[model samples]
Structures are given as C-alpha cells and as structure tokens.
Target: MRQSFGERFDVPDGYLNTASIGIPSASAGEAVAAAVAGWRSGAGRAGEYDEYVERARAGFAALVGLGADRVATGPAVSALVGLVAAALPAGARVLVAGGEFTSVTWPFAAQADRGVTVTEVDLAQVGPRAAEFDLVAVSVVQSADGRLVDLDGLRAARGSGTRVLLDATQSLGWLDADLSWADAVVAAGYKWLLSPRGVAWMAVGPELAATPVAAGWFAGADRWAQIYGLPMTLAPDARRLDTSPAWYCHVGAAVALPWLAGLDRSAVHTHCVGLADSFRAGLGMEPAGSAIVSVTRDGAGERLAAAGVVSAARAGAARLAFHLYNTEADVARALDALTP
Candidate 1:
C-alpha cells in the first residue's frame, strides 16, 4: 500500500534478507562514508562523536517509548544481557523461549556456577509459566521463524512480579509496541534497524536496579572530565550501564535511527507484513501475520539464491524477511524461486 519508504534503500531487486542484515538507508550510508573520509584525512574530532551517540540514543529511546535517560548505548545485546545476568542473585531462576536467540539466553545460562538456572520452554508457555521463575528473558520476535511473542501476556506476567527482559533485535524497526514495562529491553542495530554493526541499545525499567558491573570511563557522571579517576561516579540513570560506543557505527545510527523514529512505524509494519503475507499467499500458505516468513522446503535457500533472491537458512528453513525497503516485486521474485 503505502510503500514510499522503499525508495530510501539502494538494494538489488531481490534482496529480502533483512533478518540477517539490513542495507542502510542512502543517507546513513553517505554519512558513514563521509565520516570515514574525514577520519582518513585526520579531520575527525573524537569529542564531536559523542553528539552522534546521544542523538542515536535519544532516537532509540523515542522508538521504544522511553525517556532517553532510561536508555544506554552498547556494543551488542549479549554484552547488555551479561550486565543483567551479573546482577541476578545466586540461585536465581530465569525462563526463556525454547528457540530464543542465544544472546538473550546464554548470558543467564553462563551463570550456572552461581547456582543460577536457565529454563527453556515453549514461547507460549513463557508467559503462563512466568510465575515459576524470578525473571523471564525472551525475544520480542523469534529470529528463527519470526514468531511474535505475546506482549500482553508478558505484561501480565510482569504485573504478577516476574521481571522481564526483552530482546527487540528482530522486531524494533517495524514492530510498533511500547516496551516501557519490561525490566530491560535490548536490541542490536544491524538487523531491522538498518544501522551499521557495533551499535546496540538497552533500556532499563524501574523494576531492575542493575549495577554497572562493567563500568568504564564512558559510564562516568561526566565521562570526559572524570576519565582519569579512582572513585568512579557513574550516571544516575541507565547511562551508568553504557558500554563504550563504537563511534563510526553511532555516526551512521545517528542518521538512521532518528529518521526511522520519525517515520510512520505503523505504515512500515503494515508494508512489511503485507509483503510477507503476499509471499505466503503465493506459496499457498496461510498468512502468518509476521514480517518474516520461514519455509522448510528442500533446497529452498539454494533455489532462492539461484534466482537472485537473497535470504537466509536458519533452523533448517529458508528465512525471508520483509522490511520497509521491500515491495510486492520482492515477494513475487522469492515466490517464483520457491514455487514448484
């Protein structure tokens, strides 16, 4: 329907692999290129890059419906998850979906020696069984098959006293949902966000009072002024948990994220899901109501590739994702390739 956002990307005709990696918007790509050129000529100022980080941070905060102070910049979801894991008391119990991305589950599992236990159950069971665990960590959308978790169910679980941590890596850019209720929300920028690698974010809710266990100079109250200090004073809010940012990545994100946040996300979501449903219809499958579609056909990945339809193979299925940059043409190309 309203597919005007597709013009922002410069991808090939059949590029449908947003789940694995997104092609950056033309503006974002140009910003990164210009920043690199400035760096090459020694014209870049390290201090100025902090502004880019702040802009990206604020943009992500707006996207998730949280105050910027509640958000922290990071390198990856796993690193932020590690911070949450470290904060858990000994013998804490954590629940996660069976097929959740490892970044959200593995950190809690690694605390096995601390008497902490990580349990995997069906995604549907995550909310129903939330009362059994101290915390529930899961992805908002499953990376393997694009299954959407029940946000209302998670909200009810959190109200019943189970702390929740959500990984929004595969859902944020297109899935419009207010995530203010979760104890922690983390997302990697490279996938759905169309940002460069190394930029990620975490938003901390009032339920989780996590300490900055991996605090560095960037976590200081006045990072630049307090860089060389012994009695470290971290920011009062979520910035205390910040990992040192990857400057160049933030430079691109500074452009991409705010621009994305400003767009009609509901339209973006509809456009993506519409393309996915079109593909499903072409394959004679029911509409899945998700932006990402995964089909378990023999040699589906190879066939799609041979037809110049870019996609990914995950969990023994060919995973095709639709983003704002995709259109009906992409769905047709992918369907033609997979059709018998």
Candidate 2:
C-alpha cells in the first residue's frame, strides 16, 4: 500500500528480477560512493573499517532476530558453506536437496576428502530422512521455481545430534524465518537485501561451536597480534569463523541497513507478494508461496525483454521476482509484454 518504497530505486519499466541481482537502493549507492571518496581522500581510519564490519553484523542480527555476536561475514555464500563443511567430522552423512544451487551442494560434496558423503534427495523427502543424517542442509526457497521448503516439518524431524544448515539466499528479506530451526544460516546479500556484490553473511547458533576450515587473520581474537609473531587465540564466538569481508560491502551494507530498517518489513513483503500474485493471475497461473513467478514458454526471456520487461530464464521457465520496489503497474507491464 505504501508508495514510498518504490521511490528508493531508479529501475527500468517492468524490471522485476530481484532474485538474480537486486537493484541497490539510492541510499546504498550513495553510501558506497561516500566510502570510495573517503578512501581516495585518505580520510578513512582503521577503526572506521572495524566499525563498518560491526555495524553490518548488527544490522543482519536485527533482521534475523539473532544476537549480533552470532552473525559473521564472508565474501560469498560459497565461502560460508565451505566453513560449515570444515566444522563437520569426517565420514559425516550430509543430506541435501538434489538440484540445489551449486554453492550449497558442492561445499559438502567436497568434504568427500574428509570421508564425508553427500547424499542428494528430493526436497520433499529431506524432512523424513533428516534424522538419519549427521547434517541436513537445504534452501529456504527453491531457486529454479518459487517452491518453499517446509521448515516446521524439517525441524520436527531433526534428531538431537543432527545439525541443520540453511541457505537463505532466496527467502531472508521477503519471508519471515525463525533462524532457531537451523544450526547455521548463510545467504548472499546481493539478492533480496539490495546490497552490492561480494557481500554475504552467516549466523551460527550459540550452542554450536564451529571451526573455520580456512581461518585468516581476521578470524583471530586479536587480529594484529600475530603481526609480531606472538601467540594468537581464535575469537571466542562466531567471529572466529569469519572470512575477510569485502571492505566496500561492509560499508555499503552497514549504510543500507538503516534505510531498510526504516521501512515496514511486513508491509514490504505483502506488497511484493501481491505484485507476484497479480502477475500470476494475469498470466493465468496459480498463486505461489514466495515472490517468484515462473512461466514456461519457449524464448520467454527474449520475448519479455523485447517488451521492456526484464526477467531471468531458468530451467526453461521465465522467472520474474517481485521486490519492494515493484508496483502493480510493473506487474501489469510484464503481463502485457508476455501476452501473445
């Protein structure tokens, strides 16, 4: 119902593909520009860099309902997935949904060197067999289609010792998720978060003690202590598992979160889903759980783009993802473009 959310971005007519890469809000772009200017002028301080990192962590924590200490940063979702793989014991049986994004699947599969075996199962079957595996990893939403995984069922089926990891790339900003259901959550920020590329975050449950597979200087209790060749202690919390973040991403995400915090998240989600519903209805399709709507038509991507409607083609379907910036007018435009 709010018109102001769409004012934050300057997008093309019928631009609805937020699932692939979000158009950063105007404020986010300004923040990155300011950071670059500060660096160019030599006005940046070492302490300010740390402040940006902390600010990003706090921002993500607020979004996910987790303590700031529980959140950590990585260059990408794949890096965070690798860290989760490293924390598992060798020969651990890891269950994942077949045909998932490569970032989520390959990390655990690479653990084969550690005697770990990655088993791919249908998404529907993951919940029932979750107890049998040492770890169960899945996406909150499917990428190719907009199908949502059943989180409650998965949680109920989890055994006491079974660790659950979730790749929230497609769900975090648009859907309400209880991170408590998973031992660790990882997501790429360039999607629904409307952040710059190279920014992503991971949150670890307090009860889980995870070790990073590739620990860097940033993962230490005292980052600079080892410069003098002194004994070093790993950070006592989730910070210990952090990989070095892209500096610009920290600055941009830190600045953008405040603007995002100002908007009504629930309202924004409703607006997006409404747009998707309108599109599907106009296309003569059924309603879906999330903001992604797909139409299986040949050359669908080319047809849509020719009409000034932007979208992504995946698995032979033309996918359109609605974000807060999208309006009913945008959905109508896409539908008109798709009509033969």
Candidate 3:
C-alpha cells in the first residue's frame, strides 16, 4: 500500500474488500474515540448530540445532492426500506429484481402482509416496464456481480405515477448517483461510506419526506418536551422517519461522511475504475464500469488471502473492489496471487 491518499487507513497488505466493509479513515476512528470519551465523562452539552446527527445528515445530503432536511438517519438499510415500504400507497404494485440484496427485496416482500403486491422481474425487463408498476426498487449496483444499474435509463422509463427507490449501499460513496430520479434512497454506512456498522442514512424526495408515518419517540416534534406526557406530533420533515441510532455511530459518521464529501469523487471513481480494469486486464478479462471486478474461479479468494491479499467470493465469482486507498502494487500483488 502506497501513501498516495495521505494516511487514510493503516493499510492492510492487500485489501480489496471495501464492498464488504470499509476500513475507516484515521480521522473517523479518532472521532469515535472522542465520542466514547464524551459519553464516558458525561460532559456533552445540550444539543451536542443533535449537532452530531445534523452534521452527518448534512454530509450525506451533500453526497447525494439533496437537502439535509430531506435526509434521515437509521440503524440499517433494511430498516430504512421498511420505513419506505410502510409509507407507500396501500396495495402498491412493487417491482424488484429476482435476486437482489435481501435488504432491497425483503422490505417489499414483508409488505405482502400489508396487501402490497411484490413482483420480481428480470433485470433486463425492469427498465423498459418500470412505469407499469406503482413502485420500482432495486440496488444501484448488484451486490453479487458488481453490476452498475443504468440510473438514467430507469429515470427515463419511469412514469408520473411510478416511484423509484434505490438501495445504494454498494455505490454511494464511490459512484456518482443522480438522486433526481429517485423517490427515496437508502445506504448502509459500513461499506463505501467508510464508517463502522450500525450507521445508515435514507434521503427522501420532498413528497415522501413530508408524509406522516407511525414514528418512534425520536421522531416526535418535541421528544424531550413530550417526555412529560405532553401531546406528541410527528416531526415535519425527514427527521420523522429517523430511527434512533447509537451515539457512537452518529459520531463516527459525522466525521467519516465529511471525509467522503471532501473527496474529489470523480477523480477517486476514475482511479478505482482504472484499477479494476487493470486487475481485469491482468486476469485476461474484460473491462468493467465500476470498481468491482468478478472472476469465475473456485478458491480464488482463499488463494488470494493466502498470498497476502483479501477478496470475496459471491455467487461463484471471486470479487475484487478497488477504492481510493488501493494502489497499483496492491493490484499487482492480487494479480500475482490469483495467477496460480
């Protein structure tokens, strides 16, 4: 690992598993430590925690090109999906792919209990016929194959009545996504966002953000005031959808999300894609659009790990993901390891 990125991570020998879990930057770790200390000493001022949550929301908003008021914090992508599912029109016809990440599918599947019809479609057919369904939900990138979805095509295919939801866990930090086409978007923070687990965000379009739902104590208009048995009213914005998260996650994300926001995302993405292409070329494979490269070889992951590289095997394909922290040397080591 080279020092090109200015000490972002204590680089492992050859880490290519950002898709599974990202190595938090040094700044993020420090933020977490400080937050833990603050909690331990009980020295946090009033509204200090809210300030941290707001900072995270603001950072996520900038990343996705939405307003901070439109972004809500959640515990996980799965829970955010359930919140989105709950707010959908009754008996909605939801379209999804046959084999999507369960976080993207199970929310709608669970909607079966609410009389919502869940229809699975082939990935190819999804774009052309999206408007036919009341809701279309899919991942921005396929988790197994690292295939990037054509967001522009999907946007073009949608009708006035069609609502598009994106599970962007795989591409949010590293890829440029146009949220203009989505009614809602959810992402887990532990992956590309470069934070720890148990932190997630969901940004809703204006219409969805304004809708009232059955919310928890955190979603109350005045949670502290209502603690004295005062009348409760839901928050007026995306905060109403928030599921209370741990203070540590909020602290870490407040630090990490800004790191993502401060990046030259275009340059980082280009570098990652170029590295993926180099990896594929080394493997005598074709080019890929995203930073993920998949190869069909049994035991490839184990072999790479044994050779001082880390990777993942999913759906019978060994997966390699390159991020800003990765270097040409890392790619070369992985290539040499995989050469067998």
Candidate 4:
C-alpha cells in the first residue's frame, strides 16, 4: 500500500533472505558505516560513550517498559545473563518455561558451581505446580512453536517475592508486549531490533539493582575509565549490569527503532500471520508461529537445505521462519522449492 516506504526498506522481491534469523535494515547499515568512518578518523564517541549508553538505556526502557537508567547494555544477551546469574544468591532454584533458547539455559547450567538449581517447567503440570520455585523465567515467545506467551498472566501466577524475567529477543520490534510484571528482561539487537548485535538486559524492580556480579571498565563513572578491585555500591539501577556497550551500536539501535515503530506493527503482525496461514493453505502444510513456521515432511530437512530452503528441523517437523518484508509470493516460492 505504501510503496514509497516499502521501497526504502528494500523488502525482498522474493521469499525473504531471512529465515531462522533477523533481517537487517538500512538504518543498521548506516550506523555501522558511521562507526567505520569514526574509527578510521579517530573521531569516535570517546567523550560521548556515556551519552550512547544513555541512548541505549532509553530505547531499552521504552521498548520493554522499564526506567531508562534501569536498562543495562552488555556485549550480547549471554553477557547480560552472566551479569544476572552473578548477581543472584547461590542455591537459588530457577524455574524456566518448558522450552527456552540456549542463552537462557547454558548460563544457569554453568552456575551449578554456585549451587543454583535449574528446573524446566513440566508443561504437563504447568498450572499452580510452578508456584513452588523461587524464580520463574520464560521467553516472550516460544522459540520452537513461535507462539506468543501471555507474560502478564504467567508472572501474576507467582507471589510478589517470586521474581519473573522475560527473554524478549524474539519479538521486541514487531510485537506489542505487556512487561508490567517482569522483574528483569533481556534482548539482542541482531534480529527484530535491527541493530548491531550488542547485548542489553535490564531489571525493572529495584531489588535486582543490588548486585551486578560481573563488573567491567565500561561500567565506571567514566566509561573508558579503568577500575580495579570489586564493584562498589550496586548501581542504583541496571547500569551496574552492563560492562561494555559499543557506542556506535547505540547509534544503530536508536536509528532502527523509529523505523520499526513507524511501520504498522499490527499490520506486520497480521501479514506475518497471514503468510504463515497461507503457507499452510497453499502447501496444505499446517505450519506454526509468526517467527518460525514448520511443515512436517520426513527426511526433508536435508533435502530442503540442499535446495536452498533455509530452515531448521524441529520436534519431528520442518520449521520455517519468516519476517516483516517476506511476501506471500516468497512463501509460494519456498513451497514450490519444497514440492516433490
């Protein structure tokens, strides 16, 4: 409908080059391009590192519904996880939703050294049974099925003392989320956020500001200012959790959010839904989710990969992920490519 805008985004003429990953945009490119020039000219944001950090903080706050200062920028989500895990008391029993991306689990697993107890939700008994754990965590969206989980409903299930954390990497840019109940949240810039894959995570409640177990030079009064010895007073906010965030990364992420926000997010959601729905209708393949779609076909994973149909093998099914710019025709092309 808005060809002028669509042309600027460079939506593909065919099936999206994005599947099982995020689609980068012009704003992202421009940010990195500036970084290159800044680096070569030695004119980077040396004095404005904190300013960039503030920019990142504001976006994180706006996107996830947290205070700007409460957002912390790390190198990636993994780094953010490490900071969270480091801050938590030892022997905390962590309850996570049944299926989570690797970033959520691996860090907790490593924390076994700290006597952390990690448990996956028994989706079979997922009601009040989950109430037993001290900490509860879930992705905003299902990584496998790609279903958007009702975060508010789940967080409300826990007592006030029971902390809730959200992994928002999958749906940050395109989907509207209710983050009121979360104690902390984490995301990356790679996919939907459309920025350099700089890491960022934030805790909403003041309780989490008590500990930022991992500290780095960038976490200081002067961003580039070096520090020795242990971390001092827990940053009154999420800044404590961030060790290092690329200044240019802030510029890129800032540039991307407006464009993403300007697009009809509801329309983006609808188009993705319709495309997944149509893939099912045309191919007679009942696929799943807005982010990832799956059509069952035995031994077809290898075959499809060979045919340049970028996808993944999931729970005895083939999962195809689509994005904002993907057209129905692209779905048809993929369906055609997969046809026997």
TM-score for all predictions? 0.97, 0.94, 0.93, 0.83
RMSD of 4: 3.4
Q: Which digits, one per residue and each the tens of the lDDT, describe model 2 over residues 80-123? A: 88887877888899998988889998988887988999999888
Q: Which candidate comes out best when scored by lDDT?
A: 1
Which 10-residue span in candidate 4 carries the lowest summed lDDT?
1-10
The 10-residue segment with the lowest total lDDT in model 3: 206-215
What pairs collide in candidate 4?
75-199, 76-199, 293-320
Q: What is the lDDT of residue 192 in candidate 1?
A: 89
Residue 125 displacement (Å), model 4 = 4.7
Q: How many pairs of residues in model 3 come into backbone collision? A: 0
Candidate with better TM-score, 1 vs 4:
1
Best by TM-score: 1
The regions of model 1 sitting more than 4 angstroms off are 1-3
lDDT of 1 by residue, 73-93 (tens): 889999998988999999999
| True-structure Cα RMSD, model 2 | 2.1
How well does model 3 score by local distance difference test? 0.81
